[model samples]
Target: MTMYSVDVYSGSSDSIIQDSHAQAVIVKATQGTGYVNPKCNHQVELAKSLGKKLGYYHYAGGGDPVAEADYFIDNINGYIGTGMLIIDWEGYQNSAFGNTTWVRRFVDRVHDRTGVWCVIYVSESALAQVANCANDCGVWVAKYASMTWGSWTVPNMAVSSGAFKFITGWQYTGGDMDRSIWYLDEAAWDKFAKANVANPTPSPQPKVDQAKPVVNPQTTWTDNLGDTWHAEDGKFISNTALHLRWGARPSASTIAVLPAGSVIKYDAWSRGNEFVYVRQPRGNGYGYVAVRNAHTGEAYGRFE
Candidate 1:
C-alpha cells in the first residue's frame, strides 16, 4: 500500500478534525497576503487535537519578497507539528505585486531561517515563471484532471523534472473526494520532524536606541565633521551634513534630501558602538541607511 495524502483548505470550521483518518493533511492558509490564512490557527489547533500530521501552505502573492516573508514569519512562527512549509504559487498569473524572483527569494529566506524544506505548489503557467528555481527545492505540481497534456499531464508533470521522481504527491481533487494517497502518517511525521530541525536560532529582532535623548520637533546640532542636523519630530534624525558625498555604503546612502522640516518615515533603527543605523526607503534595489554622524541631528520627540 503506497502512502496517500490529503490537502485540506480549512475555511472556518474544524472539518479536518472529523477527517482525522487521513494520514497527512496540508492546511491551506491565506493566499497572496503573505500571511497565513487567519483560519489556520483554528485548523492548527484542531489538527493538534486530532493527533494528525500537519503541514502549512501559503498562497504566494509574489510581491515584495522580504515583506511577504516577514508576513509569513509574523503569522506562522512557532508552529511545531510536521514542520513543513509549502508555498502555493498557483495564483501568480494576476499578482500585481508578485514576481518570480521575489517568490524564490522569499522561499530561500524562509527555508534558511526555519530549516524546513520549502515546497513550491505551482501550475503549468506558474512553472514557466519559476521553473528555474523549482529543481533547487521540492515541487508540488498541480496537474489536475486527466485532460491536461504533455509534461503538464499528471504523470509527465511528475517526470518532467528529473531531479525528483515523477512527483512526491498529487492533488487529484478538491474536498473529501480526493483520490490520491500521498498523506503522511504519524510515523512518517515523526521521521520528518526528526529529519528537519527548526532553525536553531530565531530571526534577529529589530533593535532600539536609548542612549540619546529623543530629539524634539525643532532642534539643530552639528557633528565633528561640521555637518548640520535638524529635528522636526524629535524622533527623526536628519543629516544636514554639507558637501557630504552622495552614495551608498554598508551604513548609509544618498537619497533625495527633504527640506529642514520635512517628515522622514523610518521602519527600524539601531545604535552600534560607532554608528546608528536607520532603515532607508528602498528604491532601485537599495534597502537601508546608516547614519555615520548621529551627533548632528536633533529630535522633536521620539516617534510616537
Candidate 2:
C-alpha cells in the first residue's frame, strides 16, 4: 500500500502535521558539516506525539562526503535506528553536485557507522549524478507535474531510474511543504529503520564436533593506540606537512612527518573512531595518517 509523507525545513512550522494528510513526517535535520535545522526537534516531537512514522535527512553541502555523513550522524545520534535516514542531493551551492561518487561515499559512511543504508533524494533530471549509488541505496526521485502548490494527490507521473529497478519514494508535489508518496507500508517502514547486518544467525544452532573446519575468518587488527584498522585503498596528497601515524586516532604514534605537497598511497583506512585515518603500506606492517577532520571536513590532505 502506498503511504504519504511530508518533508519540512526551518521555514516550516509544527502545524505541518496539523494541516497535511501525510502518515509520515520527514524533517530536514542537518546541512553540510555545520548547520542543523533549528526547528527540527520540535517538528520531530510533534510527529512522535501523533505516532507518525519518522524520517530525517541531511542536505549535502558538497563538502567532504565522509565528514558530512559524520556530522549528520552526530546531530541525529539519538534518532539513529529509529527513523528513515535520507541524503538530500541538490545542486544549489553544492560543490560536489555533479560528482557521481559523492552520494556513494556519503551513504557508505552512514552504513559503515550505523549499519543502516540511507535513501538518496535527487531530482529526476539529475539521476545520472547518483547512478553509482543505485546498487546499495534506495532512490527517492522527485519530479513534479507542475510548480503549483496543491493538496495531496496520488501521483500518476512516471519516475525512470535506469539502474535502480524501483524507487522507494517519490516527491510528487512542491510548495510551502513538499509531499512524497512512500512505496511502502507501515511494517516495511519499520524494517528500513532497523540496523541491517550480514549473515544473521536467527537462532543458536547446535555445534557439531564432527563438522568440517571453518575456512578464512575475517581478520581485523588493533593498533598500539587500541584503534582497529581495516583494509581500504585510496590515494592521498598532503596539502601541508602532516603526520603519518601508527594508528587512526589523533593520539596515535607519529611514524613520520610528510613534507608539504607530498603524495602517498594507502592500502587501508580505520573507522568507528573520532577521526578517519588512512593506512600507508610500509616495510612489514603499515603507517597511518589523518585524511581530514572527521567532524569539520578540514582536510590535512586531499584524497585522490
lDDT of each: 0.47, 0.75
- Model 1's alpha-carbon lDDT is 0.47
Q: Lowest summed-lDDT stretch of 10 residues in model 1? A: 147-156
Clashes of each: 23, 1
TM-score of each: 0.51, 0.64
- Candidate 2's C-alpha runs over 4 A off are 197-304
Number of clashes found in candidate 1: 23
* Model 2 clash number: 1
Per-residue C-alpha lDDT of model 2 across residues 41-148, encoded as one tens digit per residue: 999999988989999999999999999999999999999978889999876557787899999999999999999888889877688998887777777887654323
Where does model 1 exceed 4 Å of error?
Answer: 10-13, 34-36, 92-99, 146-166, 175-180, 183-304
Q: Name the TM-score of candidate 2.
A: 0.64
